[model samples]
Target: MMRFILSLVLLPTLAAAQTPAADQARAAADALEAASNMLDDADGARDRVRALTETIQAFESGLGAMRTGLRQAAINEAQLTKKLQSREEEVAALLGALQSMGGGASPVALLHPDGPMGTARAGMLLAELTPALNARADALRTDLENVQTLRALQTDAAKRLQEGLTEVQAARIALNQAMANRTDLPKRFTADPVRTGILIASTETLDGFASGLSEIVTDEIEPAPVNLDGQIGELRLPVQGLILRRAGEADAAGVKRPGVIMATRPGAIVISPTAATIRYAGPLLDFGNVVILEPQADTLFVLAGLDVVYGEAGQVIAGGTPVGLMGGSLAEKGDELSPLREGTGTERSETLYIEVRQANRPQDPVAWFRTDEDG
Candidate 1:
């Protein structure tokens, strides 16, 4: 009876113990899903940009065709003008010759030996020349009108092409921003728990079975040093804040993917996580303000995308040293009496990303985070 009572007492405690870890895992999963969704959005934006680009290209091609037509029309107009001038000169010369005859002979008499034949011949010639000249002039006028119509169409088309090109450029810029935001997502998580758990369980099962048979085992291991230059430990948080993201995750909120992220109120002092020499300090790709510390020979600790940064690359920084002041909406002052004003809520909610890499490959950052009990 006493043992049963003890079991009942322990059951609730055991259940409570499991809850936090499970909750943490669920939270991690949710974050990963968010990151995935952000990536999808980015991809959709990219597709839009691509489609717009294609449309712009097509319009440009059409514009080229319109230009060719304009050139051809110009040539046709010049040829028609020359032909009209020749026809006008011929008519003028014929009229002058008739005038030179000085009315001594009938114009019809000059065309034929007999009066009847001469009149008939003159009438026939005038009828043919008048109609031919009128028809040629009309043809030229129609061609000129057609050229004007085409010119107007080309002008309109050119304007439309310019607008399309402008839209394509805007879409491209948006796509680039979306791609940058998506990159932050993967950096927020360690290995996906579902996959990691399976691998770990499989390995453990294999190890257990092998141990029973006394089989020789070979472990393929990657070497990692815990400290850099015998002075700095592994990279850690320089300030107290929530880790908003880890390395290799996508950032749904940022204009670009962040290598790491920490959330603190804006205007909050940001510090170095360890005492180490800065390897790189400046603007990084997509990280507005960045600082990289070589905490160990094999590891590079990255603090980046800050609105403000105080340190330079190659400078030595001690752990807890003020590296910069956080900017954005989330920053706040400890007290109303304090002269320092906090950042706006939006800025205060901003995150700082942290990344650690060895040989340019990403490793899980959670392994380095100290457990709550240890702290």
Candidate 2:
């Protein structure tokens, strides 16, 4: 009879061990495994650089989902543990009561001292208490099992995270090598170094420098092959990140710029938003490494604060081409999981500054790029 009661109490715990957070963690692990396979296939791909880029992106998304799931799992485990600890005495008392009832079930113990009527009333009381006892036992078993499952999940997630980090690093290196070997991108025009140098030295601001771009080229420039006016507000962000500031928002230093700032993880890839010719691809005063592209005759897209830049000035690169990488170092192994447990996910430590200039005037970047708050 006691064994039957115990089995009934634990029946619900056999349903499933996976919570929503655990399911998400499993899905993220699957994604990471797929990305690893993609990395292996990239070597023989027709466009190896693009294939590797996609692999890196996949790893990034998987890592993010894993972190979120792990964080949630940690929180759930802590709550269950606290609840169990607070009710420790109550649980012990219940266990002692059950043990006594099972051990002392002799005929003499079953008979009440008062009479047959008293014994009948005691039997009725036991029937009423059975359901309540069963319910509490079931709840306690479930909580204990859930905590155990969550702990196991957290331990397994660490291994997945390490593999993902290593694979992404490999993908990034492969992409860099492939980009260096690439030679097929078309050239719109060749830049004049002396003229460009003179123009930069004479200009005082970005607007003035952009306005004098024509002064650096003496040859008759051909019209842009692609038009981007139809794609306004439909372009995806160059990097996967969250927008930190819209255009004209003041910074901590009380300074404002006509650009949007995006917060991205370390080593994030930055791609071109549209098919455009590189007007300039080097450092400018106070903007760090910068890439300026002209999709049309009078419009310029400026991406700044990159750690590394790609492509050369006057190259006509297609949309979604790799142009740069955001700056930061990857987290050290074993230490990376701590941030996820704390619910911060390594701080999104790098920032990309984006600006759109039309007709020599700075325009709001949100007007050109689609914004997603959740990214």
Q: What is the lDDT of residue 203 in candidate 1?
A: 49
Give the range of the ten consecutive residues with the poorest summed lDDT in model 1: 209-218
Q: Lowest summed lDDT over 10 consecutive residues: which window, candidate 2? A: 6-15
Structural similarity to truth (TM-score) of each candidate: 0.32, 0.91
Model 2 quality (TM-score):
0.91
Instruction: State the lDDT at 152 in candidate 1.
Output: 44
Give the per-residue lDDT of model 2 (tens digit) for 1-375. 567555544434523565777788788888888988998999999988889888988888888888777778888888889999999898877776666656747788899999999999999998898788767877788887788788888899889988899989888888888889989988777899888888878877777777888667645457556777678988888888888888989999988989999998889989998888889888877778989998887889989999888898878888889898888998877767774533663458889999999988899989888886444
Q: How accurate is candidate 2 locally (lDDT)?
A: 0.82
lDDT of every model, 2 decimals? 0.44, 0.82
